[model samples]
Target: MVSIFLRSLVYNVLFYVLLVLWMLMAIPTFLLPRRVFMRVAKAWARSSIWLMSAICNIKVEYRGVEKIPNGPLIVASKHQSMWETFALLQFFDAPLFIYKRELGWIPFFGWYLMKSRMIGVDRDGGMRSLMEMARRAPKEIRGGRQLIIFPEGTRTPVDATPNYMTGVGQIYASAGVPCIPVALNSGLFWPRRTFMRYPGTLVVEFLDPLPPGLARKDFIVRIKASIEDATKRLVDAARAEQAQLFGRVPAKT
Candidate 1:
């Protein structure tokens, strides 16, 4: 706990200070060539990830990145860690992130998000609200952007039970875009409500996108199962890898 607190303190100072400077940089992005803004911000995300990895002693391993396309596809990811958010920003092309609208109220960030026109959902939203998402999503995709959606809705704890939300299914059906299910073992190290990042590798694996033919209901069910199965595999593989490091085999996922 002491380590967690101290690390959080140090990280907050470093990150927020940088965030302020980044906001100033955003002014030019709003006016001049947006590519310049993206370039600087992308570099910042990479540097941020590097620093966090060092301070938290956590590493990330990715597979099947080749399967990811360069268009406006919907991403259904398991929500287990905040690291995934910042880590994702490192992907440069600037994906259209689907998150709660409330995040848009966070000082300069909210302003930045508003300027960027990032999609932020309101939970108390009506049908018109989702219709808006459906509409904006396609336009963004057609304009060459990826949408990152956490179908589980929220983060789950490491020792807590996990469940799936139907939003992912709705988005795929409504948006009529290819959906990619990505699984990561981040919860093992990046537990919710804690800064005590563990020393280990978070494995992110992307399965192939859902093909047409299946109805929306069946598509949803299959996607939910696919993500869970991939997550289970990562958990088992992480345990096995750790066990091997200690000269033993893990029992189960």
Candidate 2:
């Protein structure tokens, strides 16, 4: 426990230090083309991942790069930990996220989101807000940016009951693009709302793509099943490995 706390403290301190510096350095990116700004954003993510590995003793390994299509698509990923927010950015070309409208109000971070031209959804604005999201999403798709959305709407702990939402289906129906379901066991290592980072490999698997033109109902069912089932397997596998090594499953810290 002492070792974990010390490592977490070092990782947390360095992570924020790098984050503040990166944000200040990236202010110039706002004046450049969006693509160039995104390249800088990916660099920041890479640096953060490196810090996590070097200091926190955590590493991320993902597969299924070939499964990602060349054209515009929807990357409907499992929301586990916050790690995927930036880690997944490096894999897609011009990826746009569907975030809460209020998040765009943050200082430099929000400015970064605006410059990236991400899709913002007004979750509390009722059906009208959703309709607006549906309407605006197609423009991003037409621009050839991959849309990364969490089907669960929020991060879920490992092995928790899934709360897959229909909003993702709405996006898919409106965007008219294939949905690539990505499953990961990141919560096992990084967790949500926690400072203790575990020493382990985080596995992110990109499942087969759900092709466009399916009925909304069918698309929702397929994506939920694909992501949930794969995510459960990852969570279970990680737990088993942890039990084997530690003589008991390690709880998220």
Candidate 3:
């Protein structure tokens, strides 16, 4: 336990240091095209993944990447940990994220988010905010950008009850694009609300895409079922692996 705690401490410190360095290096991208800045961002994501593996012994496997379609699409992924936010960027050409408006108020980090043209919504704005998101999503989709959103809208602990929001379905119906459901067991290794990073395989599987034009109700049901079922399988598998590594499954907080 002490060894794990020390490793987690080192990993956390290095992760932030690396982030600051990358941010400084990417400053010039602010003047370049959006794609150019996106390349920088992807590189950073890759670096972070590699660092976690090197220092924390966490191996990452991305399955069914070939299943991801080209052109405008919606990537609805399970929200487990903060890992997916940037790790998933490497797979898309033009990836867009819907984030809290307050995050856009941060210093350099927020500035880059604005430069990338990510959608920011006021959580306090109620239905009006959702309507605005629904209206703006299709335009971006038409521009050939992949909108990556978490159906649950926030990260949930491993084995927690699924609480998918209806807003993703609204955006999907309006965007008129196939939605790829992604399932990952990231919370097992990178549990939220804590600094500990565990050693184990972190798997992200891209399930089959739900075709465009389904009724909003049906779309929501299908996406939720697909993501939750696949996520359960992943979490179970990772728990077994953790047990083998540590003589017991670590309790997820």
Candidate 4:
């Protein structure tokens, strides 16, 4: 526990300093010729992962990396830890994210996010805001960039049955493109709002895409089932791996 605190403190300092520097020069990096911003951004994220590994000893064991694409795809990911955001940024180039509006107010990180043109949905307002998100999302997908949406909406329960939201279904219906359901167990080590990152592997599983034959409303159950099923599989995998690594004797594989 003492080691975790020390490591977290050191990583926080390094990350904050890097974030400040990243924000100050982000615009030019993003606007420069040849669209080399993605190159710089990927390098930055790779370094972030390296720093986290060195400081916290948190090893990420991701799978299905080949499924990531350059074309417009709706990435329906299981929501758990916030760690995947950095992984996504590093792996994919400027893929638009659908997060709450309030998160945009976060200090240096939010500034860089805004300048990068990531999308934020207002979760507090009434139905109008919801409609706007549903409305705007399809257009973004149509524009050739992929999207990363947490099917559970917000983060899921740390140790309870998982339930996915209907918005992901609605988006799949409207977007009319292949939506990949990805299952991740990032929360196992990097629990939400917690500074202590346990040394373990984080698994990201890319499940099969939604049925291309189905229409919008058909996705209501189809997509939900897909995400929930995959989430369990991924979570189970992470739990098993964590048990073996830490000598905790897991429940089941």
- Per model, state how many residue pairs clash: 0, 0, 0, 0
Model 1 C-alpha lDDT per residue in residues 102-187, reported as the tens digit of each score: 98988877866776668887877977777777677767765777677777677875434667766666666666667778888887
The better candidate by TM-score, 2 or 3, is 3
Error of 2 at 72 (Å): 0.6
lDDT of 3 by residue, 55-107 (tens): 89999999999999999999999988999999999999999999999999999
Q: Regarding TM-score, does 3 or 4 come out ahead? A: 3
Candidates sorted on TM-score, descending: 3, 2, 4, 1
Q: Least accurate stretch of 10 residues (summed lDDT) in model 2?
A: 244-253
Top candidate, metric TM-score? 3
Per-residue lDDT of 106 in model 3: 90
> Is 2 or 4 the stronger prediction by lDDT?
2
Q: Which 10 successive residues of model 1 have the least lDDT summed?
A: 244-253
**Per-residue accuracy of model 2 over 112-148 as CA lDDT, tens digit each:** 8999999777789998988888888877886798988
lDDT of 1: 0.71
Which stretch of 10 consecutive residues in model 3 shows the poorest summed lDDT?
133-142
Question: Which has the greatest lDDT?
Answer: 3
Error of 4 at 134 (Å): 1.3
Candidate 1 regions exceeding 4 Å error are: 1-9, 33-35, 92-94, 239-253
Off by over 4 Å in 4: 30-38, 105-108, 217-220, 249-253
TM-score, per-candidate, Cα-based:
0.83, 0.95, 0.99, 0.84
Error of 2 at 55 (Å): 1.2
Name every residue pair that clashes in candidate 2.
Answer: none
